[model samples]
Target chain A: MGEFEIFGMPVSLGTMIFQAVIFTALIWILKQKFLSKLVGAMESRRESIDNQLNLAETYKHEAEEELLKQREMTEKATQEAKQIIAKAREEANIIVKAARKEAFTIRTEAYENERRALKGRGAS
Target chain B: MHATRPLVQIFGLTFDLSIIITSTIAALVVLVFAYACTRHITAKKPGKMQNLLEWVIEFVQNIMVNSMGRKDNLFILAGGVGLILYLFIANIMGVPFSFIAGADHATWWKSPTADAHVTMTLAIMMIVYTHFIHIRLHGLKNYFLSFFKPFKALFAINILEQFCTTLTLGLRLFGNIYAGEVMLGILAAAAMKGFQSGIFIGIGSSMLAAIPMMIWQVFCLFIGAIQAYIFVTLFMVYIGQRVNEATT
Candidate 1:
């Protein structure tokens, strides 16, 4: 109490201590009811804001991933279709070439036969 | 002429009932501002009360964070808006409770802050709490040893600074409030003779009394708020200096 009294006042140290003790009690009570609640609300608000931001970021990334996947699938399907079409075109070319060759040979042979028959008839 | 009559007998000590009564009123005013306004506070949708509460919290939080970083959340919360409200109410108590109910001027219901005991108590508490915070931030051994600092010569000065802080903080507030209230009392005393008569001289004296009292009351508002801010900010700053690595 002596240490607490500094520059000395009209009132007793006991009275000052009593007042301070009352004030401390009030501080504790106010802490429980007021300060803690407001701080909690602020903290909760900050956390919710962070959560919303993170959620938005995740949604954006997920959307980009979905877009990339769709593009890859479409690209793969286009390449497969092109490969099939090219293979079918090559097969058609081979078949058409063989058919043309066979027709030409048959025509040539018939022409030759017809010429030979004409020659025979003329010779006869 | 300073005197207080006992309003009630509490234990063996004679209590100054006016201080209790006036202080109770001030405390209630603060309580309403603190709790009633902030009741049903929300994180998302804030009402006007919440807005005010948030503003005050942000203001105090900014001061605390500027001193010590955000890591000291416990300290911040503990030294938050409550102290400001209490001290502001305490400081301005002279305005609301200036009326003397009794025959004698000795027994008036002015602010408890006008009383040195109350202010000194708060100062002593500040001293105790400042040391407590220093120890809490830096352990006991380190806090005690740090008083020696770069050299042993500063040891006495460091110890004396704590006492000086308590005295200065307490007396500064007490002096301001006590002096202000005393001046108001003088004004009131001067005006008593004016209203007693119906003459032109009385009217002139009454006008003289009216101007200073009104002006001082308005000024009282500013002084009260500024003193409260200074007191709380100084406490935080002192603690900050103690806990700060640079100051140590």
Candidate 2:
């Protein structure tokens, strides 16, 4: 095998240079065409994910607000139920008191009439 | 043999015939598959090949986005495509030759990355590209000064780091693939010698030794692909770091 010399050195500088040029071109093409699109697509995807996350957060907030409203409605219903029950109890108490008073008056009037009739019978 | 030689000659340097043939064939096959998948792609549903191609593309895209932080770097796709094409062919290089399975010369079908010269060239390209990006982002003065620190010792350390990055990038890929080829060769030789020595090894016993080697080879193939990926990814990270620092 015969060695070829270049610049007083027995090195395949030409091959190395050729390879280097090819490599550079490949990288340049890659960077210019492929990477630019990839980065754009990636940025768009990230934005989409962020939008989705924001929407999810808004949904979560809405759900929490609905839950709080429901809780307040339940509390209001419970308080109203307690008030209605209390009012019904008060009305029942008043009705019982009036009936007892009317019953006592009727009994007293009947007793008075009976006593008067007995006195009349004894005199005659 | 003479007729089969000199398939690739540039500037009086000759590369083996089979390497160029096998690499070209593999590249063409991959390109055809990509084209076929793209042609048949649909919005409603994807075929098997389309789905597979999409998975690879999306995987590489995700890695690029995650590593580079969604910079407008279209080069990642080119890097990714080159990586996949190179790595798949490299892994399959030894599969065709049944008779010369374990011989050193059997590697006439060289995985381009398995060769130190090839890997070094790629690594140098990445280094130069990253530096170009750095200079574009920071200008020559800032880029050059970035290698130095206020403290002289730290400046020296920064220089060392740069050197190490290039060295590691080349050596890591070269070491992994070369070791894998060597391992496969050894295993094949052992199996062949065992068969020839009238050992009368049972099929089960033979499989016991062979199965692990086969599994390991598959694992090595995956590792090789990942190493290529890591190299490109690190290159992006280096560029990103420089860009972010300059902007800040």
Q: Write the per-residue lDDT of candidate 1 for residues B50-75, one digit (tens) a residue.
A: 88877877888877877766534654
DockQ for each of the predicted structures, in order?
Answer: 0.21, 0.10
Q: In candidate 2, which residue pairs get closer than 3 Å at backbone N, Cα or C atoms, i.e. clash?
A: A30-B75, A34-B74, A35-B73, A35-B74, A35-B75, A35-B76, A36-B73, A36-B74
Clash statistics: count for each candidate? 0, 8
lDDT tens per residue, model 2, B1-248: 01112234555775444444454555556555656656554543457865676676676667667766763445556666555555566655653222232323344455555555456666777677778888887789987788765565688888888788887887788788767766666666666666776667544446665887878678776877677677767766776676676655
Candidate 1 per-residue lDDT, tens place, A13-96, comes to 445545766677677766777777877888899999999999999999999999999999999999999999999999999999
- lDDT (Cα, 0-100) at B120 in candidate 1: 73
Error of 1 at B134 (Å): 2.2
Q: How much is the lDDT of residue B242 in candidate 2?
A: 68
Candidate 2 residue A51 Cα shift, in angstroms, is 13
Which parts of model 2 are misplaced by more than 4 Å?
A1-124, B1-22, B41-47, B95-106, B150-153, B195-209
Q: Top model by TM-score, which number?
A: 1
